[model samples]
Target: MTTCVITSHGGDFFGNDRHLTKLLTGLADYARGCLPADEREPLVKLLAAQQQTEVGTEQTIPAADAGQFAAQLRRIARHRYLRSTKLAEAATLLANAADRAAADGQPWTWRTEAA
Candidate 1:
């Protein structure tokens, strides 16, 4: 088993304004096709938790959502390559990308549902 960690913070940068839910849904679909069936649930749960946590803790959820998205990319690479090296590499790449995106000038968009 491998562990993936994701982190996000406030900053001004590029790639931050993009809609991450759409991106994440695409990535999840891609992972379902590529990764082992057993691994998919954990990945989904982790992502959901991360997103929810972000929404709860931060006024702006996009950066945290982006971090979760990056974590999914790391999970995909881990499933694909089945190597720690590739997992680490992908983790770094995705983390940086998410950070850059979060830093870009854009408002975080979110909708709340009635319970």
Candidate 2:
């Protein structure tokens, strides 16, 4: 399995890429239904961009959107049905990244590697 890792000053998280993609897809769907129209698009786009990255490659989620992104992810993580799942864990990880990024205004970096 390929392990996808998201790194930030706050912490790092690693999980199966396929599993993470599935979880993110769920999150995108949740965002579409629950978030306001303007807030929905960026997160959906971010999640899509993440799913598109190939193994052995890397991507960056810009600092400019960190706080809002974190807030959204936190909200998703808090969803009643999601709270106990890997999806919530992933959401929390990304939220942590955003929180850490706020201090230095650094982008969150994600990469995939052999497990």
Candidate 3:
């Protein structure tokens, strides 16, 4: 019997931080009126609160419609808007908050694909 596992080695690892940042940044894009005639008050509030937080300090990520935010993220990523370095930085910030909120307050770590 023979088995094979395939994976790419060079493409950058789009880990949780990257994904969350993409989502938050994308949410920010749509929340700013890129979306249709709709109000994004909750999202805007959430963004505002996140923006006020300082790195290496307590973060306050407001609770909002995660499903909606994720959907918007997919839309933005599909349109290739998540490719900007600015958005990537924003994602890192958002992800930092998530890590702080995670159980045990542990920072996310990368694992080998082959492991």
Candidate 4:
């Protein structure tokens, strides 16, 4: 009965502007809505830290860095959102995408290529 939504960073490339922050904000809001009040703050902090890393003042996050950030965010969400299987599924998808992109020498940006 629990619903989870993972936002996509919609753009031509990964780590474009504050896309990660927007996604994390969305996730945190969803967690607040679904999780009990006691559990929301930790999730919020996790998302906030992630946002900061994504939008670090001095350095821009590269594709690999973004992938790692996504992986960590997935872990945090899985731990916090126990009843949400979709979060795990989303995590797997993100991990797989990251792996495939690395293997193919492509950026983490989403692309549709014929198999």
Candidate 5:
């Protein structure tokens, strides 16, 4: 299986490609309306770019922006669109990882592993 891994000092998130895609899409959807264009585009674009890569390719949220992105993830986690789904749990995990990274002043990474 191809597994997605999002990690930081305080937390980590692991899921399969389908779940990863759901989490990313869910977050991006929320960001589109809630965040300004400039603040939303890079993260959304980066996630879109990552989805095109082979499993195991790694990507990072620049440290400077991790906090804002994490906040967005948390909001997505609470949003009605994802309620009662595994994707919501995945979003929460991703948020936790990014929140940890921001607190530690480090970048959070997203990557996949072949198992």
Candidate 6:
């Protein structure tokens, strides 16, 4: 089946669908698993002592550019800190979008409620 993108005349398609949720949750799980319990959140334990001290930077959260943010999140799986944080931010953005759309009585993506 050809998965259709629901978009507008000049705006990006809404990406708060099941796919985005799955990506965000899956990456978060992997990121936590990548490290032992004591080191899952490597952001705090910055690798400042290493040669590559760059803090795994990526483009700022693309709230208006859903597709781009989603693509970037999908690519950074190996960088657990980057992947985990980006996934969380992306999920928040999508959730906000879904909330706004629902409030406006427009077509909205069904999102999973955080437990």
On TM-score, the candidate that comes out on top is 2
Q: List the residue pairs that clash in candidate 2.
A: none
For candidate 3, list the clashing residue pairs, or say none.
21-91
Model 4 Cα lDDT, one tens digit per residue, 4-100:
2222343226522222344545556655655556645654564444443422133223456556545554554566544555544544455455444
lDDT of 1 by residue, 1-115 (tens): 2122223321225322222333334444556666567656644554344334333233334655665555566666566544445334444455555655556633333332212
- For residues 14-48, what per-residue lDDT tens digits would candidate 5 score against the true structure? 32223455445655666676566767787677555
Quality of model 5 by C-alpha lDDT:
0.62
What stretches of model 2 exceed 4 Å from their correct place? Answer: 1-5, 10-19, 81-84
Given candidate 2, what's the lDDT at residue 67? 75
lDDT of 5 at 113: 49
Q: Quote model 6's TM-score.
A: 0.29
Task: Give a tens-digit lDDT track for model 6, residues 1-115.
Answer: 2121121221246343332334444554554545456644432121111122222322122233434323333334334356356555544444455444544545433222322
Ordered by TM-score, highest first, the candidates read 2, 5, 3, 4, 1, 6
lDDT value for model 4 = 0.45
* Per-model root-mean-square deviation over C-alphas: 10.9, 3.7, 13.1, 10.4, 4.0, 14.9
Candidate 2 lDDT over 1-115, as tens digits, reads: 5344445554524321233555566677777766778777988887766566677777677787787888998888887756457777777877777777765788766665444
Residue pairs with clashing backbones, model 1: 12-103, 13-103, 13-104, 15-101, 16-101
Choose the strongest candidate by lDDT. Answer: 2
Question: Model 3, clash count?
Answer: 1
Q: Backbone clashes in each candidate structure, one number apiece?
A: 5, 0, 1, 0, 0, 0
Ranking by lDDT: 2, 5, 4, 1, 3, 6
Per-model lDDT: 0.45, 0.68, 0.38, 0.45, 0.62, 0.36
Report residue 43 deviation for candidate 3 (angstroms): 2.1
Q: Estimate each model's TM-score.
A: 0.34, 0.73, 0.37, 0.36, 0.68, 0.29
List model 3 lDDT by residue over 4-52, tens digit each: 1111111245333322322343456645654344655655555543333
Runs in model 5 deviating more than 4 A are 1-3, 10-39
